[model samples]
Target chain A: MYKLICKDGNAKRGEFTTVHGKIQTPVFMNVGTAAAIKGAVSTMDLQEIGTQVELSNTYHLHVRPGDEVVKKLGGLHKFMVWDKPILTDSGGFQVFSLAGLRKIKEEGVYFNSHIDGKKIFMGPEESMRIQSNLASTIAMAFDECPPHPATREYMEDSVARTTRWLLRCKNEMNRLNTLEDTINKHQMLFGINQGGTYTDIRVEHAKRISELDLDGYALGGLAVGESHSEMYRIIEETVPYLPEAKPTYLMGVGTPANILEAVERGVDFFDCVYPARNGRHGHAYTNHGKMNLLNAKYELDDRPIEEGCGCPVCKNYSRGYIRHLLKAKEMLGLRFLVTHNLYFYNKMMEEIREAIENQNFASYKKKKLEGFAAEQGN
Target chain B: MYKLICKDGNAKRGEFTTVHGKIQTPVFMNVGTAAAIKGAVSTMDLQEIGTQVELSNTYHLHVRPGDEVVKKLGGLHKFMVWDKPILTDSGGFQVFSLAGLRKIKEEGVYFNSHIDGKKIFMGPEESMRIQSNLASTIAMAFDECPPHPATREYMEDSVARTTRWLLRCKNEMNRLNTLEDTINKHQMLFGINQGGTYTDIRVEHAKRISELDLDGYALGGLAVGESHSEMYRIIEETVPYLPEAKPTYLMGVGTPANILEAVERGVDFFDCVYPARNGRHGHAYTNHGKMNLLNAKYELDDRPIEEGCGCPVCKNYSRGYIRHLLKAKEMLGLRFLVTHNLYFYNKMMEEIREAIENQNFASYKKKKLEGFAAEQGN
Candidate 1:
């Protein structure tokens, strides 16, 4: 169960009560793609750095250690030592994006593993079962992530198939919750809405999923290589159709700037690998802009990555030292950058919630967008 | 001035009162090769994780940022945001190992920068002046780190040249400290004892440098490719010749097992890149033995890297998650390992100090080594 703690116009400040803990709304789930955040951020570090939720990939866990193995080891939370709420994405995205020789049918998809080329089958039921085995607080319904430039006919067919899969996911979740072996008996299932870049199709699909009355609704298939305006237009058109009472998650929608925009349009949850991934390339997100630590200009710049930022990296390390690490190709440099980026996103959400509570969200949104756009030099 | 606080057999506990802060002896200085720990550990993380002294390379910093630039930016402490003591290496080792077109003369060595083929000159005075520009608490004397398997004649000439360099280093350090333009007026100098695996030459060099009455004395040439037993034998033979009242630092003298052996042999200070370097490769030091996170067995292991490890990583992360991060080539994986390894070394030192205090040093060393050896077989 969750409660709407506060609201300001289209924006909401809420709390999601889970078995593990409660998560504040407009929260950013740090992406731990394979049950660990890339760049070595541990669950403890995540907690210290103010992460509310950890999002793990059902596909990666299912492939490497096997969901059954995780189940035997007492679920993903115990395996990763993350006592906070964890949301496990349905393996559908990876099946579409990472797997080889994928064959999609009405029931499910059969594909070869990207790691070992081993045959694997992932349907709605299989994804639900895997999430159940992992015992995550939130399990996403398996829905085909359609290609960005998909034909209208293909988009329509994919949405219908996704709706059917959502039903199977719901039924499987119900069965798993009743099973005594399940680690989280009260696990919540969030249904995903998928339609390729078409607002009419997206709104219709969102309306259909809203009727199912899932715990939450996610706007999927937008950030899959579409124009930012097109993605924002789809969200703006379709979000009103989703249940206003439930949390609206924008799956894999990104960046500090993107989150601010999405939150202004009323996205309550978000997850992205940008912070951890971009950190590996030596790019750190600062309030001014994304600073590349590899740039020679930072060689002797003794300033922190950002002033007035209280992250551990910013609080004690100078840009000069961080630049040195990046130049040396040290992993610590990446870790520091990723840690700062994640902290930046989480802190931005806090500020967003504060603005919402103060009834100044409009001003806050305008200011933040302007600040970010200024960094873009447009 | 440094003061010897306590002594139990050959194991001594002491404190070096520096301009920045007091440094506790039998201390391990965390190495920041390029002004940053190789893994994403920053100065703030270092402080939280119990680091007292940080070591930076003179060669790398001079090459990349340039010493003149660091001086312009208020020296390395302000540059790195570490207020505690910092020790800058003389660039002698890196110049010999990493630089190109090295030419050794009685005055100094001329070499090309490792990053660019630009010609550079570094003698004892230049090394001391660069460290003074960086304003590190302790500046290591510049000395030629002779290649292993050198003939007796070569080693003798190198040691003699190193002696001349030490005199120059001491005189330049004094001159820089008195200069009004110097960034660090209180900078201290530590003379290096280099004899390249020859104990008679090492003893003579140590005695000669001891008469210079420098702030500290360091045994520099032991770890550069000599067998462990041969290095241990040299320390056993030469340590008695070094002044008992002054602090004795062993440069780049290593692994947890190696450190324990050195501390027992009356070495009061140590620095090495092993913890951070080995960690990036997925190797972690545990009380048991070094555990490789890349091993398949760790994939489902839910325990911390060490059971009682109080570091942030061990407090909340599982071996399983760390293994997954390492397998994924994540920087966070390397950071966690490095953080844990540094914590392990520092904690071991604390334990060693405690044992010495309780007059149980002998038994503690024996038991710890036995346990470590037994775990290696597993």
Candidate 2:
């Protein structure tokens, strides 16, 4: 179900085939956490703006519509009307982040739903079952996302638990796939690597997960709170040990600059809420730099957000108009910014893939980073 | 420079030529009351979404940037970055609606600026001078928008004072146009008719303003607090008295159904904030009726706001996504709805013009009204 199409040094371009479609490797999955991109972007908007795989949260769907409800509605694709490859995070990150009262044991985590205080138990097997019900193209393996600044002893024990969780997730996923009632029999699993900022622990976790021979491997727990250099260091140390032929996913890794840096470090497949979040705050990423529409300087700026941006917002709207909307607390202002930012991220990834294919990833990375950082002084 | 292009019954089609551009008559001027569409739509969004002329407020601009500041920036068109013809409302309605401390007299209403509560005086000459400085394609003559249910005696005096204001406005506009310093060298004037709900007073005022030979005329003060039937009745009584060659504008007159009814009653121009305002509240206009994006039924609806809406929002987003945004308090959701609503209104006008041209307006009006009302029932 996965093929490596091209390789340049440590970087590789591949394709992951699913019922919806085949997604090109190094693809950026637009984060639609709850079957929709936050900030009012629609499925049609996503398609127009060049989104590939849409990543939904299994926990969110399970809590709201319930996986059974989505299953009844013909799974996530029909439920969201996005007939493109969709990868579902196995309720791990959200369950770790959102659940107010959680008890971790050898079996699983018992927690209360964030939506309501209903007690719920989510383990590796339950996570796999939910992903099967949703029928996603890719099902992320259940893993514990460790809290930042943990002790070395705590980090080691957590990695061991995550490894154990992976085995159960894999076994349950296989069992579900064989069931006739499962929504998707061909669902693929991507195992996640979890460790604190410790390089040795990260490599150890990566080595153990690789033994599972998952369809893809994800480097998680880095972007959580670590510095750019620290995150880069971990990826540099651990990626060479992971299977090079399989796609490397960077879970919840961010911004255009971050993505470019990660891609150069041989990481593919990313999802982040930054573009949509920053857009809602009236900031938009342009090739020139990020601009805040709420600033008074844009009040009468007749120019587009960026001179040559092809996004609908830039193609038709002036900075003055966007600023006005922002000032008035209008929703269109945020929607325009969010749409533009997502388009920018998606476009940036396309450029990165091209650079890697052409064997000039180094130059592309240098120019893109310089352009993004240059705006900081302003 | 205004031409009567076609006529079907009392309903007619015309074109008003302005220095900026020629404006198609019976056109619906999208209201951007304070140089921005109220629900946060920008000028660029307007152009792509089919806004022909943007209507700004002399009162709002004069209060915020001040007409002098806009003059420094170079007129309303340059300030707003919309090259299309723009029609600016005289500060009359705002002064009546917003001014905290106000006193109306023969010279002009004396009031405080709504924004800063600074003492400000606006007579016909002042209104003309401000509009001339702002350099809009067309400037509306200052007229007191009388309150509904006024006694016949009060209505008579108010209408008489409004006539005096119109003459002063015309004289001042002519003088300003000849001055080399004036931003708009040939600013056209559109005098307004105002006479509570008194039919006799309306006809008399319309006749007097018509004789002034202003470039266009407006039916104001209706739709303020009157029934739709009452507003239509007044239009029928007064429209015949106005010059047939010039365009007739209905200021702030209402819903999709209301516009259709008014067009059939011989009104030529219209402006309203309903589409944008309603859209911000999550209500969208569809052929089936108005769909509220905040409703729970849309929580899992993978369909667009409307199945075939050509607006960017509907073209690209699902109803479920829009609902999610609204629930999350995301501005993008509101912006999408506002953009879509404005597009719906502009498209309706285009269709209305086509129906008139094809001589099927009567049947078109019947069908549209039935559909809209039926949708509302559902």
Candidate 3:
């Protein structure tokens, strides 16, 4: 269930309730691609950092540990030891992007697994089944993520096929929920809107998917090499057609600046690998842009990653020590940065929510963007 | 200062006070080579897992980030954010073993660093100066670690040189502590006893070092390629010559069984890489022997690393989940196992101390050894 608490212009504040827990939005779901946060972070660390939701990849879980194995071990919640709500994406994106030699048909797509080069088939029903086995709080509708820079004709065809697949996924999910053996009988489905850079196709697709009255909607395939202005324009054009009562998730949309822009355009849920990935490379996000810990300038600097921050790493460690750790190639350096970066994102979301509730989100967004720009000179 | 609380035969229960903190005797020092526990664990994690003393490598720190850099940034205690007693080993072991083409001389060993292959010299005074810059609570005396299978003549010459180095180390440490700019003004020195596996040489070296009345004494060069029985016999023969009032450390001595054997032989302090190293490789130490999480048998086993264990990992994670992480190449798996293994060692030492205080260490040692042997079938 979704509750719209307040709004400041197009920026919306919301709360999403699930079987696991209630997540306050606008929220950033920390991406734990394989049921564990990369950079050696645990669920306990997630809780300590004020993370509300965790997003895992269905494709990765289905491939290595197998969704069936996760089900036998009591689903992703018990498997990961986190009682917080989790959102598992449909395996379509990974299968389309990561797998080798894929052929798409009405029944399903046939491709070889990226991990082992083994053939596998996944249709709407199969994706739904794997997700049902994973039994996450939210199961995304299976849809093909069309590559960027596609023709209008190809975009139209892909959107049509995705709509049909969404229908099948909805039906399969309803049936699966009624089964006695289903792990999450109340699993929520969120349909994805895909139309590449074509604004007309995106609006049409958004309107069509809104008719199904799903629990949530997501704008996917937007951050795939598209310019930031084009992505923002597409979101502005497409979001008005979707129902505002449900949550709006922006999939794989990145950067603190991008998040601020998308949130202003009414995107309520977000998940990206930039924070975790960049953290591994020794880049730490701060209020004043990003700081690379590997820089020699921080060798003798005894400041936290960000002064006046509330994260555990900031409270206890110094940039000098962290720099030493990174130079020594200690994994804790990456872990520390990851924890700080996630906390930065999560805290920003909290501030965003507070600004929306206070009806000052526009100024908050402007000042936050200026803060980053002032340091990054972008 | 060392206080003897009680004793059961040779096993002693005591407490040693340092400037940083007081350490319970029969303590196991968690090896944090290069100022970090190898398996992505932080000092905060160490505190949570009840780690008493953190042992760092003088060689590793000197080579990377450099000890001078650590001093400028405030010292190892602040550098690693650990306030507990830290014991930095003299660079002697690493120079003898890890360095390339080392030439041992009376002034000190001349060799190239293992990391950068930079030509460097580290005699007793140099080792003391580096450790002083790091500002650790206790610094081991710089001494050569004689290689195994050495001729009697070689053993005698190496031991004589080590004794001379110990005298130099004591003088340097005392002078460094008196300096106005030294970070740790009251730094303590622990002399090392190294005579290969020859009992007569070992006894003479121990007696000669004990006469210096340093804060502590250590038996080095025992666990290097020697039979377990032979190593145990050497400990039995050499520990008595060292001062019973001061702590005796068994350097690089290993395994749960090995620690128990050494404890029964009157060794009160121990440092080894076994728990953290074995854990990174998927080996977990338990009361009932060691379990390799990489083994296929643990794939579907839904049990903790050890049931009824008070470790944070055991309290939250399952063997099945950890095995999944390992198979998927997740660092959290190694981290969980390492935390659990260190807790296992620390908890065992606590039990040993308690058993000694209760005056039943012999029976306790027998029972603990039987527990490990029963599962390992050794």
Residue B137 accuracy (lDDT) in model 1: 94
Give the chain A TM-score for each candidate: 0.97, 0.97, 0.99
Across A158-237, the per-residue lDDT of candidate 2 in tens digits comes to 88999999999999999999999888899999999988788889988888889889999999887888898888888888
lDDT (Cα, tens digit) per residue for candidate 3, span B93-129: 8888899988888999889988889999999999999
Q: What is the C-alpha lDDT profile of model 1 across A284-324, one tens digit per residue? A: 87666777788878776777888889897888777877777
DockQ of each: 0.55, 0.28, 0.81
Q: What is the interface RMSD, in angstroms, for predicted model 3?
A: 0.8
| Model 2 chain A, TM-score vs. native | 0.97
Q: What is the descending DockQ order?
A: 3, 1, 2
- At residue B76, candidate 1 shows an lDDT of 87
Candidate 3 per-residue lDDT over residues A9-80, each given as its tens digit: 998899899988898999999999999999899999999999999999899999979999899899999999
Q: What do the candidate models score in CA lDDT, each in turn? A: 0.86, 0.83, 0.92
| Per-residue lDDT value at B145 in model 3 | 88
Model 1's chain A TM-score stands at 0.97
Clashes of each: 6, 5, 0
Better of 2 and 3 by TM-score: 3
